[model samples]
Target: MAALSISLSAQNVTGLQGEAKNNLLRLTWVDSVDARGPVYIYRSVSPFEPGTDLSILGRLIKVPYGVQSYIDEVEFPGTWYYFVAASDTEGQRFELPLPPDNSIGIEILESSDRLAVSPAAPPAEIAHGGEPGVNSLSAAVEGDSVIVTFRAEDRGRAVVLYRSARPLKQARDLVGAVIVQPDIASPFIDYPVPGIPYYYAVIFEDDLTRGTAALYPGRNATVEAVEVPQGSDGVGLSSSASIRSLPLPMISLAAAVPGMNAFDETPSPVELSPEASKALEDLEPVQRKSSLAKSPRAFSQDLEAPGGGEEYALYSIMQDFFLKKDWDGCRNALAGYLGLPRSSASEARARFYLGQCYYFLGQPRESLFEFLSAQPAYPDESAEWIQASLAALVK
Candidate 1:
């Protein structure tokens, strides 16, 4: 009888190398000699040990035979280790370099570094069958919230996920949040614990495939509670209820001037000297009103005084803007006033005007947000405005 001889075929992936462009890593390699099996890619932050189970190494991608490259959009800036393995048609798996070789490595630097070395590259376009492509992602700390903005190619849906730490391994590791849709621009407000950092990522999914991108890394960003400036009046209103119950009278053109209905007639823009303009510019509208309270010449006596002397002046200005139907001017002044530290009553009034301004501007969402923010300052007074905003939103 002739001796039977059998030989095992070699299935090895070779020539692995990576290049870092911005936060994205592009990996390339030569296909295995036995091109009959699928290739699996694995990644880790630390070096892989000998005999490490390819199954447990956090599989990043699986490609059919003949595909030689993959692009990974890394979430955090650091070094990453990667390796590839191939499985034969018979289901026999073999690591690329067998037992003694080290995994390929790539170092992702900070965004600033990438910006310095090259013109900052636009985010890599992730293809998701007819889904809108996100062009950019940015976050800014505003008062106590993180405002995240996403600019996309077309209007579509996206799911946001966030974590407090680095190296986001998988989608399951993140806490899912808002589902954003197409708008002029998509903005999501994340109310995180003050002083804690956060990292955000968004996933755009379609029927065929899903694309993921990092929104914010929270490296130098953090939420900080803003301190409201003290008002001229010593007393401050605590809650929205207190503001609504206050005896402050609403200013209307009918009450501001005798025999002259503001709505019936337009008021000329008030002329100001360069000195007065400069002075007013330096102070918030609320603070400016406080300054005016010291001078009786700033306002007419016919306007009823509400709350403190300062509020009387503010109401006078607000009434003038409203009577003239100058929505833009009214909105700007109201924004300045609301940004200052104020009694709840003052905040409530500012929010009301701001909400109305937004409504007139055809921005129902902003109108609703202002009305809701005012709720904590004056629940009763804001209820009507809130209802109006909600109605506009429904329309």
Candidate 2:
């Protein structure tokens, strides 16, 4: 016999959170029949949108013939809309009637603080003591040696410069050049190499008066390079190409947000072996990037045992990845652990990690999938965190 998918009521989907409340999204539904199935509660930033286009956002399994209310705790504080549906083991889907006109309610609330957004590209400006117009800058390339110079104001601090072989958007490729200090109206020079085109920008910095013992750049802008001299030699004002000065547009920030202090700066009083120091140095910046890139490899490298013998190793690796903000890697490693044919304890641990990974990756829907799958494998006490992560995903 073909299985019957659970159809739900309109009231089950209506009367939900209508504002951003920093609370879980409450969902209720009535199963048509007593069927053991995976009931999914889907949410969207927009109303009545399909699962894929709009983020699936959240997912949950409705218990058979029980009080079918699920609290999704993963929603951010914003105007959010949602929909609900259920599916049977046969993969047959039955969608609940959507709210009137297909829009879920929202109660707006506040979200917690997070990491700062990365810095953007800089613009062009006049050098200190120069005329009111923008400075004239150019790129001179000569056989593996490229000299880039620009005239900009000495804005009371060192002139911070950035050079990129590619366009300005690829921040990973942007390397920090020397900072030309304030009160200096000198031409800035950087070597980028010949034949390779490049983009450049300079920023002027000022002491951060708001924070104690801190310095901040007052303004940043980009300028057009006026000259690109091919095979230009060193020494003397080699003025071959005529250049023009153009002021880079200024960007604005809405508000001053608190900056994050890096954990690596937490000085450890203990001495370190030469090998440990080298290893730590190697893992510093590259740790985060490598974790993101090699999540699968890290996952495969973890060892598991017949009992909980391998739990420590797994936890250690996951902890390392989590600290590095390699959430996807954590999720993949957990998923790999879950796929292994192992005891229930190991599976529970894996599932817990899976939930954490999903939460950090901003995929509450998939995170929900992992949480519910692992819920039964864990004890009641341990499952609390599992449920918490699940609840977070649905909201």
Candidate 3:
């Protein structure tokens, strides 16, 4: 009899799980020899030992020759044995990698599929969706009940409530007990024991594919809980809910005034003094420009082209160095600045900072490398300033 060559293959399954469910089994293979017909598939009732007779529960017949796939949905969740063999026109048989003599059945490890969560579940009666809108919870002066109002304009995942004693401290979860979405008015009422100052935040969980997401999108409000006054009869009117603005402050005109400012009245810019300006100018140009000036967001905006449309990549790196106070980060950002496309003048300024970063790192030789790179790139007047610095370094 002539020999028939054979091979077998397998692969890990992916995208087979969602929410809390799993679906479909996927496999891959390579390097097979003269495969013909649909690869036959079978499930064994029990684990088959090597060289043991096993029951053939089913077969995936007529598998096209050289085909590397066989998806069997007939099998249920349990261990099952599988074997593939090729039969020639003359009835000659060749088994791929020969099954472990009657080995344990192929493990059909299955998991349940997660039921579809209605992006609209909690009912229109309590439905909340899109991003969380205004979140306001205030206690009525006459009664013990507190009012909680919010708008869920966009459909999202679950909405949760957290309460903190201190502003922005770690919060304790207070989500379901108060109220859920699909509610009538924007604010609902919750009765709490009196005499504790409470800070509340409503978190709208994003429809997250990955782990990264902003837990809470809108502004958080704080209110202290107080005992209902002894004799008041009428229910206190709740304050009108306002749209919560972005948590991070921006330099746009809308952010300047409170009621007048388009965003909300926060504050105005404090003018820098002449002396402060000159002190800032003493640093390299990039340093002077990169330092925190007004709001962090505004400062970040100024790093790129005027009016801050696209962010300069180098500025982002530099900001990390400034915030982290990491010398190594400064060095990395300095190198990145050098690699940026810029006019020769800008290059000279960037090189000067490269030297400064090295000096900060206590590497005078490496600092000299950057200073040398800057000398020819800068004008004589600028180069002279660097020359004077060399004398200071020696001294």
Estimated TM-score for each candidate: 0.30, 0.24, 0.20
Q: What C-alpha lDDT values do all the predictions have?
A: 0.52, 0.43, 0.40
Q: Which stretches of candidate 3 lie over 4 Å from their true place?
A: 1-23, 34-38, 48-50, 54-60, 95-395
RMSD of 1: 24.1
TM-score leaderboard ranking = 1, 2, 3
Better of 1 and 2 by lDDT: 1
* Candidate with maximal lDDT: 1
Candidate 1, after superposition: displacement of residue 174 in Å? 14
Error of 2 at 1 (Å): 28
Better of 2 and 3 by TM-score: 2
The runs of at least 3 residues in candidate 1 whose Cα sits more than 4 Å from the true structure, single-residue gaps closed, are: 1-9, 96-102, 112-395
Tens digit of per-residue lDDT, candidate 1, span 1-395: 12221112246676666777787777777766764688777876444545666564445577777888888886665456677777788766666333212246565655444511111111232111223255345566665455776655546553333334343333333322222321233577555544444554444433101212232222211121222233211124334323222357766765565666567754445579999989989986563332111111112332465776658657766677855667788788777766768777666666666777887787766766666666665566666655555445444
**What is candidate 3's CA lDDT for residue 205?**
33
- Clash count, predicted structure 3: 29
